[model samples]
Target: MNIQNFSVASLLAVITLSGSPLFAKEQTQAPAYEYGMPLDIAQAVRIDEPKSTVCEVGQATMTYVDTHGQIRHVTFLQQTDACAIQ
Candidate 1:
């Protein structure tokens, strides 16, 4: 094959390989809670049932009152049965 054609083929191969999930690194997610970490929930209010999106699963947004009387917003994941404080 000609140099021009070879270069185009090599470019396409590189693009396809780079975009493949097999070559991509697995993303690590942070745990919901840490060991020995104290979390006191004074109150919890569910905002609504969120619609599922491409990047995010369907979850509910909740407002919470902590031990210190601070209001915090958390996303409750139904699949994991856990809440992530935002």
Candidate 2:
């Protein structure tokens, strides 16, 4: 009945409506690929092999589609003395 009480009630109603799911924002999905582990060798499309000083140090690149159907590039590196001549 009081003016002050009526104002407080209106403010509370506004806050509640704003917090409801109908007014909430949508969320985006995360990408399927990230750094760290190597991608599946079978799915990769060999792209390039940059020059290296020796056979022991080799580097190659490839591309493939992730589970999300997004294209991704990956680099492979090898560093070992196995290729060195005795």
Give per-model TM-scores: 0.36, 0.36
How does residue 77 of candidate 2 score in lDDT?
Answer: 65
Off by over 4 Å in 1: 1-38, 51-57, 79-86
**Model 1 residue 51 lDDT score:** 49
Candidate 2 TM-score, true structure as reference: 0.36
> Where's the lowest-lDDT run of ten residues in candidate 1?
25-34
Error of 2 at 86 (Å): 9.5
Which residue pairs collide, candidate 1? none
How would you encode candidate 1's per-residue C-alpha lDDT over 16-51 as one tens digit per residue? 988887444333332243456566778875565554
Candidate 2 structure quality by residue, lDDT tens digits, 28-71: 22223345764644465455655544556565555766666755
